[model samples]
Target: MNDQYELLDSGNGKKLERYGDIILDRPCAQAVWAPRNPGLWETATASFDRVGGLNWEGRSKVSKAWNVEIAGVVMKLSATDFGHIGVFPETRSLWQWIRSALREQAQTKGRELKFLNLFAYSGGATLAAAQAGAQCCHLDASKGMVEWARENAKLNGLQDAPIRWIVDDVIKFLRREVKRGNRYDGILLDPPSFGRGKKGELYKIEDQLMTTLDLVHEVLSEDPAFVLLTSHTPGFSPIVLGNLLRQYHQSGTFECGEMLLTGKPGVNELPNGNWACWINTFS
Candidate 1:
């Protein structure tokens, strides 16, 4: 985990954060509680205000673009129109989990694991897996994001690493991989609730999640290691993710929980998302 990124405060439908040297306040739908430390909000460098669209308020001494290292993965950050600073701090635990699993497998199994990352934005998980000695194929539908991920790879000095940056829809890529007889020992997914493919293919989480999981199961190696699935959709719960995993894998340790980040000012655990992960011990 990087010491630079911190959740300063969260409540009243917004979250205050420290990304490297920058302090930012952004809208958070899950922050339904009243703010405990309203005084700290005044000191924020900038804030994302949701009006007719999204807008940034206040002024920051920090650069509009910068870099930060999280879990040994260097990522570029920007105060985007989408209300994100290009890095998700709550995923620190998940990265650690994947690294530990890969390390253990490398030591005991004596094999370099292969990983597939779906909806791999900016390549954080891809970098983590590669650093853990896993060859990875990163898939996303956005070309700009793929290029940003490439820059991140270069920043980490992993330019020669076995990471395939693929700019394609996750479902389409998975189907193609299946046809090519390619499989992976580990899988990571962070599918958006609603999105459009490069070719304008509609993706609605409620309708496509299960079918996507089924496709994922098809491309998994026989002796699978891990499956980490996460969702930020409001209606999506840990139970839903767990049930989806159970539909494909019957016997594995399935741990389901809400991902949280502790805010500095109020020390409140802000729920960022939900996750369900499986570690296969049977095979």
Candidate 2:
């Protein structure tokens, strides 16, 4: 699998990265240190910052949309006002792990596994799970993002795959799934620190994450495969995520780590987020 994403260098609250043929300089709040490859930053085709609230420089240098293959999944990338491209490169490792876990579970159970992804931006994890032969449900609050994910699925020749693309509030959707007795063998979620739902329902991670996890637990099938939770919010460390999952699961093998943006030989690996996962032990 050819990964088209690379973090060339990062420091001084910014990260320089290459996505396919375009190089972008984006804000990285955690990169407080000096950049290692100072000279490499000059190659950035475009840059985004929040100095006066969300701004992009040299945007005309790049196309509006392009394709990038990361972790064997094809994604459509476009620069957004929020300083995010359609895909997040840090989750590449998580996508690979999801594929492996789902494949193992399907083989062991001799049945197709069901997977669910919440707050699924651009459907990278969903596509990975589908590629591993899992029936997937991809949900997000933004209709535009859901459509972008569908486009990505088409880009990967998975338009006809067993994927349920949904645009709804995460909490409301999960509740409906629970009521419908719909359960998944594996679940992946990347919740935002704060956001509004489809009906203007406010979601603050500090206030509602536990409730969200409780609802997620209700929708999980018995003898499940795994649960992966990742976050980019500051102060939400690996241990914080692991502890949150531990509250709902007691028997699984738990692991947590910093999600990194990795590059070639000399480039520094930047910790872009944190992830925690609980994997079931099958006999």
Candidate 3:
């Protein structure tokens, strides 16, 4: 199966993707009843045999590995959950927000900052913050994902760096950090649509987000760089996310909007996901 979805050409029933040394010819759910390209179909590096699973076709020569590069940050990608790329390309927009917040905070505060990334996945935002002059603690519930994040850090030559890789449930970790009086100046959260924590700490974004937002609010110092919330959940709107931030943090100029993908008008010209940004403008 193609670990990274390199949409070589996508239309009607299938998407052609170049994954590492192999090409992928697969059916897409979104391509309902589209034309079938038999010629292009034969050139697949691999193909997922079904929906939401990574089964392959063709003589796949490489291991199941993928990488996404954005703004000089390299993210080693893989499917940690059902069929999800831990660091999806749609998330580049969120990384930009993280970079913007950190850069602005560094200039104004005249010092570095500490960053907290919850549900960090493969460290796309962590790499961005660390390279932007923030000491970041990357947290996730999956050990494999934490390892993937660590590999990405090293892929960018950031191994042995001051970054802390914590493999734990996000809520539990945050609670302990709060109790220890530890705080962060910059925070990034990319919650799932609906899932359970390692210890089964129920997480339904629509139901649990408001409370989590309030929890995250308490962990932020009075003077924070920025707070970002990115949700790929189909039902959660960016405005609602911003509303939650406003309700909880009450400080800072809160602005929430979708992360727009910048590209030409044809293939990749759409905002893939939503992001809400809150800058503590209380200077």
Worst 10 residues of 1 by lDDT: 55-64
Runs off by more than 4 Å, candidate 3: 1-44, 49-54, 59-62, 66-68, 78-82, 260-265, 268-271
* Candidate 3 to native Cα RMSD, angstroms: 4.1
Across residues 14-43, which tens digit of lDDT does each residue of candidate 2 receive?
Answer: 999999999999989889999998999999
Worst-scoring 10-residue span by lDDT in model 2? 274-283
Error of 1 at 139 (Å): 0.5
> What TM-score would you give candidate 2 relative to the actual structure?
0.98
Query: Clashes per prediction?
Result: 0, 0, 6
The best candidate in terms of TM-score: 2
Highest lDDT model number: 2
Score each candidate by Cα lDDT.
0.85, 0.92, 0.71
After superposition of all CA atoms, the RMSD between model 1 and the true structure is 1.6
Assess every candidate by TM-score: 0.95, 0.98, 0.82
